[model samples]
Target: MHPSTLLQLALMGLFVASIPLTMVWLSADANKYRKLVWVMAFLTFDLIVFGGFTRLTDSGLGCPDWPGCYGAANPFIAHEQIAAAEALMPTGPVTKVKAWIEMIHRYLAMGIGVLIMALMFQSVRQWRKTHQQAFAPALPVALFLFVCVQGAFGAWTVTLKLQPVIVTIHLLLGMGLLAMLVWLGGREDYLLHPPAPSRDLAGLRALRTLALLAAIVVVLQIALGGWVSTNYATLACDEFPLCDGKFIPEMDFEHGFTLWRELGKTAAGHYLQFSALVAIHWVHRNFAMIVALVLGLAAWRAARQPALRKTAKLIAAVLLAQLFTGIATVFFDFPLAIAVLHNAGAALLVLLVTMLNYKVKHLLDVSQRTPANADLPANSYR
Candidate 1:
């Protein structure tokens, strides 16, 4: 990529990011910082969904280069190169349409980077002006670093030729970034309006544990799903209730779980077998049941608490939708829209769990601080 191309892409990101920044500045809200963080979180969610679209459409290698399309800022500027590639392999990955999709995804990612930078800047300014530690600058600084790392993985996704591990980590890092932003936003909301004391402090603590466990299970399930997607194994089995119409089918776990191999080959460099793909799909399919059960139990427990009922309902609904979409992907042969929604559903679950975790923590803190609870032993809440 040329210096000129880098500058142009940076300028484009700035232009795109400015739209939301302008809205934040123009709003009458007292806390522009909080509003900006929430907006970034929303946009990050959008980026995750669009990224799934890019992957599902096989646009990951549309440019065959990093940070630019064929060493140019946009697809139009690299039309000649793209056209040549497409001409060489008309049905391959380098079509003009894919170039556009790939570039647009990059542009959105860069815009998010710019917004996070703005957040860091504002945090520093707020701390300096108010001399208050409440406006901590550490998280914004951490976010800046995380996004840089995420950007590096994005580049590797293209340069490494869609290596399964790199692509899957890229997906996980994007979701992790969203989780951090939601946690930050929730913190801001809590500081603005602290929650009331809870009568059942022990229950709240248990709920927090459950929510965290659910989040872990969801992350694992997502990793399995990513492996399936990156390895192009969605249709390996082609049956839902049982793989290949049997309770157990021939599988190659050793080959399937080889982490450092290329996209569709085992560590020994042999072409990945159908049994390996079946193993990949089968594990993801079975894990979905575990995730559904754990998340459902958490939702049922959470719904009994008035403060958490609404978010609990949301959790339950998304879990059901995820189940439907996960099965639909198999039954419908992985339609683009439903497949993308499956990814989005995973993101939504991450957000909800993070939010629930934050809320429970907040309630626990309130319970600890109340005068009525002062007489109780520290472990009494447990």
Candidate 2:
């Protein structure tokens, strides 16, 4: 948090951000804004995945400080402090490797922040030139603000000692950033190739609603998963189809669902009950059924529409992979690799569902705009 450390962090962010900025500048694509949007989207996705890796490794508090490592810019400078922490507790959170992992995650996040700032600037400049909706600066500006808030939560994750709610919200906000970026990219893609008039206006309208519902369900499932992870309840049950040898599995939802308590503690400052952990794991496990059903239905409906077949396939594939990873983590005792994949799968689902939503809305719009569709009945497309 010192001035020198702040300067070093700023330079690091700029250096990391310059890679994509340079790529966008030199690309053959005429719409550099779209290119930049997508590059940030990809980087944001990486950030989310790396974040999961950091958490899975119990490295969230590696640096034990925000924006820097032990008041230094990098782990090397803070080696003495980290070493002391590790020396005090050999297997604790502040080991040298963990400090590196946590700092790298922070560096990537800062780099993404710089890219979002660039996006907002580019959007404003482009809007001044063309005044097109695609280049509107509002969402970019909002992204800028949102990332700042997310960064705050990142700091709180460490300073508050990884309070479950704070960490969970931080993960959710990262996913929200990905959702916004994907939607923005989709907007640019739509502008580049507008949709053709749909032959089934009413069908698309219904599918749009379903896609939206799927997204909501996925988000909820993610929230539950985050709760389970942050609370270290992933192994509470240790069995798939049955939780602790019973479908119901004794659970304490009252303490488990308490929103604002510290990690592993009840609101009354008592240690959380084992049943509470069971409740956390149980709900996430069962709710996945709803997620599969809703996403499967959306994918099925979208697959029937030629324009959406590819995206539908991706949704279905990722869904299966996600479910498999989730179950594997249980059967395999939550290996780090599979656990990280489970998180990545969730992010991919968010991206795919957002894409589905965008395409359906576009198709519905195209159908409504056709002159021949004016006299069509409620269920008619032709």
Clashes of each: 0, 0
lDDT of 1 at 78: 94
Residues 1-382, model 1: lDDT tens digits: 6798899999999999999999999999989999999999999999999999999999999999989998899999999999999999999999999999999999999999999999999899999899665478998999999999999999999999999999999999999999999989998888888766666777778888998899899899989999999999999988779888897999999999898999888898889999999999999999888998999999998887777889999999999999999899999988999999999999999999889888888778888688787565433322
TM-score of 1: 0.96
Whole-model lDDT per candidate: 0.91, 0.93
Task: For model 1, give the 10-residue run with minimal summed lDDT.
Answer: 373-382
Q: What is the TM-score of each predicted model, taking all chains together? A: 0.96, 0.97
Q: Which stretches of model 2 miss by more than 4 angstroms?
A: 374-382
How does model 1 fare in lDDT?
A: 0.91
lDDT of 2 by residue, 66-110 (tens): 889999999999999999999999999889999999999999999
